[model samples]
Every structure is written in structure tokens, then in C-alpha cells.
Target: MTDTLETQPLDRAPATPEDLFAFLDAHGIRTTTVSHPPLFTVEDSKALRGELPGGHCKNLFLKDKKNRLWLVVALEDTAVDLKTLDRRIGSARLSFGRPELLWETLGVRPGAVTPFSVLNDREHLVTVVLERAMTAHELLNYHPLINDRTTAIRSADLLRFLRATGHEPEIVDLGPPSGS
Candidate 1:
């Protein structure tokens, strides 16, 4: 599938953080952002985020055996076992997608992956999966397509934004880590 935004020129540059915020505003998805030290891992976020409240998330850009791309967003603490996640999500084997594919499909690099990047995926080439537990929180947090800032939005607004981008995300109960 040609995974390019239909409304934008093929030569258009990847969306920037500013573009992401503008798109969110255009959609009326209320959000709040805070700038902080660049965070490259969940541990970095925990150390620097001090008092931010919400279900902070980790986004995994994955590719299935069939070459299908997936964006799995789960709580920062969720122990996502790739060995077993495929069965629950109805896919063949799953592996982390490469950085090139991530940039091509979602317009973000590792350490900055966010569901918000789906705005660049106008063709719906990526399957978004939200952890059921994460959605139970009143608010969710993720990078605004960058690692130096975090943005919080209501869980419902997240669903609204994803749908507005033509990605009907799959909310799956990924369950406790194996041997819990």
C-alpha cells in the first residue's frame, strides 16, 4: 500500500512537533504539554517527570511477519511480551520495526514514538493497539513527536484523535506479564 497522506503533497516534509500540536488543536482534542529534559527511556521519564500524573506510555513500532506495521501503545510499566502479544492481536510473529520503517510510516524515531505520529500515516498502513489497562486512566501521556516534551490528553480524546486520523485502534487486554 502507498502509505502517504492523501491531502498533502507527496514531497511534503514529515510533520514537526508544531504541526502535531496544530493538528490536535484543529481536531479540538484538548491537551497540555510540559517541557523537560530529553527522555529516551521509561526510566528517564520516571526520573525527570517529577509530578506528572496520568498513564505515561511507551510506544512500540512493530512489524508482523506479514510485513504489517503496528503501533502498540501501553502503559510505561506494562510488560509486553512480544512472544505472546501476536496471538492476542491476531498477527503472525511480531518484531520491532526498524528505525527507517518507523520514520517512513509514523514520522518519528525511536525514543519519540507516539500515537500522535499517526497523523502522518494518512493511508492507515499502521495498526494501532492500545492497551486496555492504559485506556482506563482519565489521562494519558506521551511525547509530542519529540523526547524533550510530554503531552497529556484525556483518554477519550486520544480515541477521538486516532479515529480522526482514520486509525480505528484495537484496544486489547494485553494481560499481566507471563508468570505473574
Candidate 2:
């Protein structure tokens, strides 16, 4: 049974940056990309944002106490109080996933993790978390799959891409409650 599944044409192919872009285009989701030096951290990509018009992102690959994995995509400037983040996402405590596991599950290096990596998650093991504030933005930017380039897409298109990949994201307000 496993062998038959592996040979099926419907099975997902190994994901690549080019494949990601093609997938985006095929869905009628337009995006613009720029090539630059590799950027692995939010701070590293700051300067490049000058030429890009969008909400730059800080993507986090996290794991919970029960080993459930999550990929959080939030505005780069959003304050992340990790201590309180699990409550917002319904996890029993969360910590950054190790680099090895990041590559193993998302098929990307630590610095290059993006929501797009979910394409490689054929097992659907990773749950995506999108910040509410980020959803308010018209445009958002993240690495396509590699850290050497950035791709800007409409925020709605992001949700579309995630759904298309069979990973419907959990949108949450990562910040403190409005009244609090």
C-alpha cells in the first residue's frame, strides 16, 4: 500500500523555490520577487525592505510539549512574548524547533523557513499560524524557500496558497488582548 502511494502521480513532488513560484503563478496569485544576499533573520532583511513595499515577516517554526509543530508567520515588528504565545495558539508551551527538525519537516534551512515550506510537509504535520495584524496588511513578504530572495504577495493570496497546499492556517492575535 505504501509503495503504491509513493508511485502515484498525485503524490506531492519534492518542493523547490521554483516549484513554489510556479504554484503561485498557476493559482493566479501574482507576486513580485527580488534577489539579494541571503537573509536568515528579520534584522538581516531590514535594509532590503526599503525597496520592497510590504509587511516584512518573521517566520518561526515552533514545537509544542506534545511535539506538535507550528509555523508562525507574523509581522517583523510584532512583539513576540514567547512565554504567552502558546496560549494564543492553543499549545501546551512552545519552543523553537531545532534546525535539524526544521530541515527535516519543512525542507529548508533555519534562516529560510517560510509558510511556503509547508509545500514540503506532505505529512501535514505542521500547523500554520498567521498573525491577525499581518492579515490586515495588503501585502506581505517572505523568502520564497531560499533566503537569497524575497517574494511579495497579497495577504489574501497567502491564505489561498496555504489552503492550496492543504495547510489551512490558524489566524490569531499574537499580541495582548485589546482591552488588556
Top candidate (TM-score): 1
Question: TM-scores of the models, in the given order?
Answer: 0.92, 0.88
Off by over 4 Å in 1: 1-11, 177-180
TM-score (C-alpha) between model 2 and the true structure: 0.88
Q: Kindly report the root-mean-square deviation of model 1 from the true structure over all alpha carbons.
A: 3.4
Tens digits of per-residue lDDT, candidate 1, 1-180, equal 333321234245779989988988999988999999899999999999989989988999998888788999998878999999999999989999888788777778789999999988876889999999999999999999989999999999999999999999999998874356
Give the TM-score comparing model 1 with the true structure, all chains together.
0.92
> Could you tell me which residue pairs clash in candidate 2?
none
| Superposed model 2: Cα runs more than 4 Å off | 1-14, 176-180
